[model samples]
Target: MAARRKANRILAAVLVPLTLLTLAGMAMLWPSGSKDGISLANPYSAAPGVTFDTGKIQSVVEESCMQGSTAPGQSPDTGGQPAPAGSDCMFAFTEPDQGGSPVKVVVNPEVAQSHGVKPGDQIRYLNLSNAPGAAASQGSPAYIFVDFVRTLPIVILALLYALVVIAVARWRGLRALLGLVGAYFVLAGFMLPGLVEGKPPLLLALVGSTVIMIGVLYFAHGFSARTSTALLGTMFGLAITALLAAWATDAANLAGVGSHDATTLINTSANISISGVILCGLIISGLGVLNDVTITQSSAVWELYELAPGTSARKLFTSAMRIGRDHIASTVYTIAFAYAGAALPILIIVMLYDRPLGDTLTSAELSEEVIRTLVGSIGLVLAIPVTTLIAVLVVKATGVRTAGQSAVGVPDEDRRPHGTSGAGAINADDVDDTGALAAAAFERRSRQSTEGSADPATTRRGRRADRG
Candidate 1:
């Protein structure tokens, strides 16, 4: 307990200063004009652009056909022909422009007037779009599209998930949060930048993933043998996945299926390689499953060891293999289902085309998904055995005693019993004698009890003599 507390204290002391220093360095590195030298528009630029606030919309004017136009066969626009000139059938508001203060903006007032608002009435703007060249100013309201309503439920769900994680996992959840932040930094500060700089995608992925795995697993699970074993197993699995992905990419003649997005990225940045980016995608796709399987296997092995510490390595390995088998079954299905869910629309489109199933399966896009799912599943499946084996070997080699041994020590005589031995005083015969002696003592007590009992014949003879 004392050691744990001291370790915590040490970590706190080191981490606090390190965190402060890191933040200070980041602050120093940031452009003076913008926070972190990052612009929402041009994220990769050295100098960030100035920020401006645009005024919000005061009200919105929505126009629709009157009840008279509700006939099913009627055209949707039968009753409305835009807002009439000079009519109070428009909404108006104010907005700010770039490098300028807020100015009045006039929207169609038809909907507002219909809702009982007049020229001098004040109304809140629910949705507004900021025009280009907006200026930063106080009391400026922002506008959003009416579709923003859809985000409410999503936000609520996110909050609920966060609450559940915190409530259930507690400190581990906090560590996970920290790990998430660390991951963002790694991706933004290291991985993305390195990839954009034209580094080998596979190499970058390996290094970045390694860093993330170490940071996240250690932070969440703490420094322990199980965590280390899991990390080792995960790395092994990742290596296999990487190698297979590389081989498949070459053998299958994958051209990355580049879309407009990739083209746009290429047009914007001269330093990035499209093919490398695709490879990076493949590597990253499998990383999560690798971590999950390895960690799960490691945990299972440790728990099994705890349950039966005296069990031989072969037995432990067999027991862990059973767990690995179950994990492999579920995890393979999980990967396939996950991809299916993501590509359901594509699958539906393919089915609608009435294409041959074999042809559709062999298509480049579908093939990519198949390769990703299979490669990741393979990694997950392989991680379990590797982790279990490592864990068994480690636990056996470490020779850590079980909890049962703490209360009682082996009997001294049994520890070195008399036997026919040359070097060691104890031998197998002494153990045999101990067992034999215990059995013989039990048999002797039984015989004596039977002999000491009064004889029925003697009692009968005594009765006969008395009668005479």
Candidate 2:
């Protein structure tokens, strides 16, 4: 009991001040909570309000859209090379908010194929003011050409994912889901806005993710020595991940602006550093899985000690490492396969390239993926052992025992490795742990109990002869 309190005091002493400092730092560096940086608009372009929101296609007509064109039953084309502008294309759409109210719009055949639209399709409209004297009023509604509506599908998927997780994991899963929400809050609230404001993306990622680590692990796993040990290990792994990401990014000459989206972002926001942002993403991308590994290792160590309370620290460490090694192996494969699956399209393109394999694989796109995988793998692999070590030490230090019990001392006879030669080969100090001594005492007790029982050979015969 006393030892457990001492451990608690030590952990509190370390974590309390750390938490206060973290809060202070976060308050100082938190973003303005404004989204202006990311919501960039071209000042010369059309107003945002003029654009149409999402709507559903109501009806379609095959009649001519041009002036002085006949109805659909009459002949609209002669040669059939290409249909005229006002020929065979009209669509009616109704906004979701305003049901049963349909708006008609002409579709240009030239650009008609570019944006395919049919009846019952969910789409976004471009409110063009083509009608004569047509204003932005209901009587003269703007032309509602179709784009796409992606909102509903994504929302449905998110809800489904949440249901499955909570259903399977129950309470623990509920906490994990909440932790995920908190993590997303950190990313969207801090990391993203920080990047938009031209803050060092790598630094922002490290700080924001570390803060998230503290929250997510403790919140999902609970606040205790076990969770604290996991949190420490995760933080250490994140630091390693950041360092390795930086080193690998520069080493591989990763421009981080390889994709079209990145190029567009850079052109629009010249202040942003694409490479730095990519490196930041790289470091944080490993955080979720790294947290998983560290936490599992921590829990494993504690649970192992709980099951075998009399085991020495050395035995506990070895058993925990065995689990860690398996986890590391499986996790490494998981990382590799996951990255490969995401990059499969790029891999196909690279495979099609006629250049040598080395040349094709060293391209900017492939190199970024390579660097992300390798650096993340290294950090994850190291985190397992590091986390295990910390957890084992922690549980041993913090665990409570009954009177005359030991956390690091197993039975004296149980200390030797299996199949070891006679006792002469083993030293007394080596086999002198509480575990061994306990086992020896237990054996003595069992022998005494057997001897104290009435002798089966004498009881019946002695009684019969004496009575005769």
Candidate 3:
């Protein structure tokens, strides 16, 4: 008990101060509401007499790629050059939701060739019918496809995911979902704004991630030695991941130059550092997987100790690590496959290039994902044993009891059934009353069978009858 108290005190000493410091950092680094430094062009910001409207596709048709059909952000052909034979474009006839005549909208060529729209699909379009030059040009374009409306399907999937989680895990799952919301709140409210203000990326990620874990762990799992142990393990893993990510981002030169979005950010804002963003991403990407392994390892240790209360600390750790080994194997694959799936398009593009494996992997396009998987796997793999050891020590300190005695090194008397003087009885006191009763009954039956098997008169009678 005293040892457990000491462990708790140590955890508090570490966590409480860290949390206070993180909060202070957040307060100091909070962003101002001004957007003075941002100068990115907005594509969807409509000019006078132009509107962005939603509509449902009435029908789609493939027509010749001619001079008049212009896509969004495309200018009308003024060279008077005829389109090549066999070239075509997709045009969707759509009815506006705001009560207007059906208009023919030209779909973007990339969208049309990749994922063409059909009738009854909701879409957003830029309506330039009332613009100044609309009446001057011949066959001037009116509506152009901007994007597909995807709100309904996304909302449906989200609801289904929530229902399944809550249905299976009940109130705990609900609390976890709520904690996820809180985590996002911190990410959006504190961390993102801080990044926008050009705060230190490494410190921003670490503080934000730690605050998230602390909130989610206690809020979802509640306050206990087990949870605290898991929290400590998670923090340790976070620190390792952060340090490695910072080094890898610099050493590997993950400048995010290969990504279009990254390039846009470079052209858009001077304050944002692509390398720093990549560094922050590398750290944040591993948080969920790290937390999973650590908490699971901690729980496995405690459960092992509960099942075999007399087990030595070393044995308990060994048993727990057996589970941890399996978790580590699966979690590594999980991180690898998850990143692979997200980067599948990039992989396909690189594969088509038919480049050497090493070259492809080390390329700017693929290097970040590769490094992310490796770094996350390393952090989580190291956390497993640490969590297992901490849990073993804590469980050993708070030893289980039976009849006012520690279950570890239990007395012989306590190992036997009450009101009986028989050998071969297992330790009934190690388990609850119901299990103890079942053990005693089984022992009694075994003793009776042994006595019957040793009856000399009965054996002789059976042998004589068989001979006759």
**Which is the leading candidate under TM-score?**
3
lDDT of 1 by residue, 185-253 (tens): 877776787776666677777667767777888898887667777877887887888888888777766
What lDDT would each prediction earn against the true structure?
A: 0.60, 0.70, 0.81
Q: Where does candidate 2 have its weakest 10-residue lDDT segment?
A: 64-73
TM-score of decoy 3: 0.84
Q: What is the lDDT of residue 241 in candidate 2?
A: 93
| Tens-digit lDDT string for candidate 3 (94-185) | 89999877888989999998999999999999988787887675655578899999999999999999999999989989999999999999
User: Which of the two candidates, 1 or 2, achieves a greater lDDT against the reference?
Assistant: 2
User: Model 2 segments beyond 4 Å from truth?
Assistant: 1-6, 33-39, 42-50, 57-120, 129-147, 399-404, 408-468
Give lDDT: candidate 3, residue 263: 91
Judged by whole-model lDDT over C-alpha atoms, candidate 1 comes out at 0.60
